[model samples]
Target chain A: MSEEVMTPETSQKVTKAPTKKVTKRDLFWAWLKWTTAVEVPVSFDRMQALAFSFSLNKILRKVYKDQPEELEAAMARHVQMFNTNCDWGSIIHGITISLEEQRAMGNEEVTPEIINSLKIGLMGPLAGIGDSVDQGIVATIPLAIFVPMALKGSILAAFIPGLIYIAWSYGWSWFLFNKGYSLGKSSVLSILHSGAIKKVIDIASIVGLYMIGCLSAAYVKFPIALQFKNSNSTVNVQKILDGMLPDLLPFALVLGMYFFIVKKGPHYLGIIIATMVLAIALTFLGIM
Target chain B: MLFKAFLVGIIYWLSMGRTAYFVSFAFRKPVVLGVFIGLVFGDVQKGLLYGATIQLLYMGGIEAGGNIPSDQGLAACIAIPAALMSNLNPSAAVALAVPFGVLGVMLNNVRRTFNSFYTTYSDKLVKEHKYRTLSYFSFLIPWATNFVLYFTPVFVATYFGSGLVKAFINAIPTWAMDGLANAGNMLPALGFALTLVVMGKKQYIPFFALGFYMYAVMGFSMLTGAVFAVCFAMISSLFKQHDDDEEDYA
Candidate 1:
């Protein structure tokens, strides 16, 4: 049994247990191994809690080899309801590990209550931030760039964006995990509070919206081949629409679909089915 | 075909809900699945074309708040294989894929509900200090559950349904197939519309208009439009930051 070192000034109890040996390499490896598994079998009950415990399995085993009660406590702490952005959520894992390790080392300040509260409190904000960045920005940028290419039948468009996103997300998550481990809990808040998070979200939303618009014009091809015969000259409806505005039908169809999907509140399947029926009817009647 | 379907079903299960990071990315999207299906059918180009067309139908289906509105991967797997086996046009394949996507949503819900039982068991295991067993409950059990859910339907459909589908396609009139193809062409508008619904707000409608005009009227390429959109995003963000700073000083 190693003696506990109490630092009065920092209020951090350092446990000098000889068996407790979790290196930085171990934390990184755990993150790589467990990031995806964290969401597998994610339930409404515990969310990612079980997977979190699994990720910290090795560290917990080493840190509390002699302290069975504490080991049990640590496992139970992580099994509570936890949900957050899957990739960015690894920061929580890193921070929790640090706290658990310290607690095992005789840090009375890092209680189960504190750890649980920190996790519950931080997850929502981190999810908000992570969703905005990962889904809104990181995911969207590559998607926006490659989607049009894919639409044009370019194979590279399909593979490149996904690969880049995977690589970028992997690197981003690894970096955040290390940061959380090194900075502990308090400094994580300072990083979040810096206002850059807001800026990223704002910029991402703008770009995402604009690119979608571009996608609608470039890819959505809805043409009405109907024309009216006039006394002097035959009028082409599609040509007239083209003269008035390029891709007018596509634009309107997109907006109508948007309104129907968002406000009309039919399930996506219903709308898809309805569109098929309407399309078939229109094509048969030569009205499309 | 049965072997391929089993593999695709497994791919769908792994990519959507199972463990493994990069593997999921490779198969989750229809475009990738299209390539795989094409490889299976010995027609990579047609598969790519079909997959891309189907992929457009789901370009906006972002998984938000953990609710996947449609299962594009499953749709691609089922649709591409069926279309290839039947010699149907890619456009008709998009329409054909929709039902499978809906069914996938239902199955996904069931999978989620069933997995909840494991969470309870995990709680008991932790209490019992059965630490090692947690990994099995967390990873393996859910995986097996997903494998069973996905593989069964796909295998049955592939083994028994292919000849029936080919006969059915052979029996259908040319006009009906054309109608279906037309419907498929029009369906993409719904996807684009859905994208706007998710990402567009009234305030940001101008950017949508800007993107549309730049491409539709100015005849700018998609790449060019993207560049302009990026520039606009940067400018707007900078101006907004300046305004916030001014408010702070005030």
Candidate 2:
């Protein structure tokens, strides 16, 4: 994993004609195009698909590097490269390269590469955190709040989340990308050795775990019930559990689902269908 | 009124139909299409609000291992608009969306079928060197057209369907009205509870109790409580590093 990054020696040389007098309009279109490209899913192995957009950026630099008048266009072209090449890979990598590339004009070339490794090490764990925060925490909480509020006729209610998330989602992406890149561009190697990445991963994991707990409560939708009526008494077993707490039955259900998945090796996609069918079938037999 | 519903459906299909799920998959984030619906129905704020609320209702709704969650996109787009358009209570709006969410699963299957054809055609196109045609058909044009086909029906139906539903409810006998009303009020909580059970993990029972107590006993909404609990857990987690690191030692 610490092997040196592929460098300028092998940088794919662009032969496309110079971006013909690229303008502000070209910049917008460039951003839009790359953002859309980045939208496509890539093979898990390499967010290498980002290479396509980054390559486009390189081509832009080649064409516009000499034209100081086109510098802003080139910069927009760079950020727009993200939009088209916009996977987590590109976002993270672009920032790393942006930092390294900036520093490279007068500094060590290897600095960017070393900076990327520690940053790269952080990516998977960050993915865990990013996925949890963006997909789980930020999304679900606002959504749960938004639904009821909208039900109540508050128009401003929805935008509250948008404002919050646009900031969080875009902010985190931009922050981490730029932060990772800037750090990578500098000392590059010591960042990881500093224990900062470890601390970051540790914090993210803890948050992710708590989210799993919240996710358990928020997402799972079952409760246990054992109803018994003697000559003079009645009980809901679920009520007893509920009295103990909200998620006992839920925890049990998840355990059951997890075991079923783990032990049975249930195919992930088909498991829901199979379980739903089994539940329905059991209900038909008056067993569920 | 029916046309309005149909129009809404068309619009939703256009925006979300062709590639929303995949688009979201790209970002690994749900589209929050509810915000879009809220805006369209002259209640962007309300729509977004409702969307977030339901987001919790399906937090574990992932497509991991091919598991299709209740189609949240369809739920937000259709159910939310139905709520606004029908004058049905928002609770009723949510109630209406549940069944339709299940229907969305069926629609998603239909989409998969189309993709299969697209895939097969790609092979044939490759064999014949029909690169331009294959790429165009495989990726772009089909989704563009299907967007119209999928969204139009939904908008149209919401306008008409909610009206029809309103009519159907009015036409229902008084005796059934109480039952329906009671069911509407109880079902979501039931659904929420059921969902909690569906996605549970061992040793996480207490949090559920906290959630249940917040909603059932303390009169706090689950969202507020969940947020509180999550934050508390986060803070505790920050402080509990000794414990986690100790576990790492184990």
Which residue ranges in model 2 land beyond 4 Å of their true spot?
A: A1-88, A92-126, A144-151, A175-194, A211-227, A240-247, A258-288, B1-3, B14-56, B59-68, B80-95, B103-149, B152-250
lDDT of 2 by residue, B66-185 (tens): 224556567666667766666555445554554555567667656555544544444455455344464354335546655654666576667557667677656855434433223222
List the lowest-lDDT window of 10 residues for candidate 1 chain B.
B241-250
Alpha-carbon deviation at A224 in model 1, angstroms: 5.2
On residues A1-288, what C-alpha lDDT tens digit does candidate 1 reach at each position? 224453574333333455575687789777965776766777766777767777887788888888899898888877778887777777888888888877877767888888888788778767655654555445555665676677677778878767876887778888888877778889886776667755665666677667767777766777676778878988888898889888888788778877777687647667766777877777777777
Clashing pairs for predicted structure model 1, backbone only: A15-A105
Q: What are the per-residue Cα lDDT tens digits for candidate 1 across B115-157?
A: 7898888879988888888878877788788888877776677
TM-score of chain A of each: 0.75, 0.58
Q: Candidate 1 chain A: worst 10 consecutive residues by lDDT?
A: A9-18
Docking class of 2: incorrect
TM-score of 2: 0.59
Question: Which structure among the candidates has the greatest lDDT?
Answer: 1
RMSD, each candidate, Å?
Answer: 4.5, 9.1
